[model samples]
Target: MTQPSPHPTLTPQFCFSTVALRDFLRISRASIDDSITQNLNALYTPAGQGFDPSSTSVRAPRPQNSRQIAPSSCRAFKDQVLFPSWQVRSDVLNYCASVATSPDPDDPESVLRQVESERDRERVVNERLDPYSARFFPREARTEMLAAVVRQERSVEKIIRARSWGLVGERCGGDFREWEEAMNEWRKAREK
Candidate 1:
């Protein structure tokens, strides 16, 4: 006869059900959806009003005699704006997908970290869109906008600067290089 088990809870008696798995996935998806909505809402002011175009607080003085620059050629727009923005967005989405599907998806702390990472990635997208902003904005307005960006970045510097390379192995599916490269891309974009 077999001896009594020391760790009965570790036995194979526990059952897995498709219903449970489906419920878990549904909840996770809802949580992610809420997070996306919250982030989008955070872009607006507390009063629910967006920046005022008529307000000169952030606007640059326009030269009375300045002529409007012609719109970018199709090739220039594709090369300079569309493709680069798409690549950055694609990289971020791919990174998030890898992390979400990692082995420890059940860990709550890891989930929080992933959420913070997504926010940082969103900021990178904002910075990447700066060139697109330049298409219609004045030089001084661009400078002021960048300064605001820098200020906001400083507020989140601690979170952004924290890099746990050890966790990257588990988070990135046993390879940290992909995560490192993606993070470097974010940093490089911010530098510009």
Candidate 2:
């Protein structure tokens, strides 16, 4: 048989218009699930040795720093195992629900207003259960609650602006400042 060429030939860039992006996304999700399952299995059974984080004990020499680090490290592990799946599932369900119940795409202003209204309602509920008002409503309860609501509302508004700017930048390939200006214009129009 003839000897193979010493150097392999490089293939030219072929246009791949046949593949749908959704197919790639599905493949990626499958691969991620497989990897996560593999990792979980390895973590659960190290060389066929059953190991549980809750039952595991660290026998390191007690150090002054151990007290501070131990609780936080345990918390980190607990958070990783408990929160990730719940967050992913909740996000997927929320996205599906939003899509199923989405309002008219042409009415972005109405959607924004609805979001703000929902936020305000949440603020009202949160204010009623404010931690600071636990014992009993003092003389300044109304003033304090009003101030807390305003502060919380401002924080929520800031979060909304940041998220909106991120979406605007992604969709329009523009800076956040441009988004902020557009937001201001929208606010003025809404005020009218």
Candidate 3:
């Protein structure tokens, strides 16, 4: 009797031409991107205005250790760019703590979970400390926001395209719609 192979081999159920496979993949990616864009729009539209810093005027003290001398609104916007509010911070910290403490120390999956939790906790703490840091901004909006805030006049589209910064900057829920809304709010505030 023939011995069964130790490693399982995957057999293709159907043959696909290279072009067809590429097209399918392309369509799948586009569908996912569109869904994400739609969801972001729904979650952060006209009603979710409070979190936007550009829409309000405040004379709050400068954030600790920040060297930015930009307009107060801009500074305020940057301050709340990460995590949205204190509630998010608390929840994130608690979740990370739970993940770090509840797992078996010797299990590989548990070890990885602990390490990831520690890293996430550290990132959240760092973001809380310096939300204005460029590293916290999404790739698509980072340079554009910097340019606008610093009053630099230049086309950012070419740069964004060259860098291939995904069609919809979804990092940390940051997207073009949010960026556009923030920009419009800032412009209106500036005009006042």
What are the per-model numbers of colliding residue pairs? 0, 0, 0
Q: Can you write out model 1's per-residue Cα lDDT over 1-192, one digit (the tens) per residue? A: 111112112111111222332243334333322232332223323333455666666667765323212223222332343224334333433333434333443433555556666765565334464765323221232223333433443333223223322222222232335434655565576579
lDDT of 3 by residue, 65-95 (tens): 2322224423343233211221222233333
RMSD per model, one decimal: 28.8, 23.2, 25.5
TM-score of each: 0.20, 0.24, 0.21
The TM-score that candidate 1 achieves is 0.20
Give the range where candidate 2 is weakest over 10 consecutive residues by summed lDDT. Answer: 9-18
Clashing pairs in 3: none
lDDT of 2 at 83: 28
Ranking by lDDT: 2, 1, 3
* Global lDDT of model 3: 0.33
- Cα lDDT tens digits, model 2, 1-192, are 111112212111110111222233234334333233332323332233345575447655654432122333323322343223323323433333333343334432555566666765565334466765334322322223334433443454345435534432343232446534654554466469
Candidate number with the higher lDDT (2 or 3): 2
State model 2's lDDT: 0.35
The TM-score obtained by model 3 is 0.21
Best candidate, lDDT: 2
- Which model is ahead, 1 or 2, in terms of lDDT? 2
Name model 2 segments beyond 4 Å from true. 1-138, 175-179, 187-192
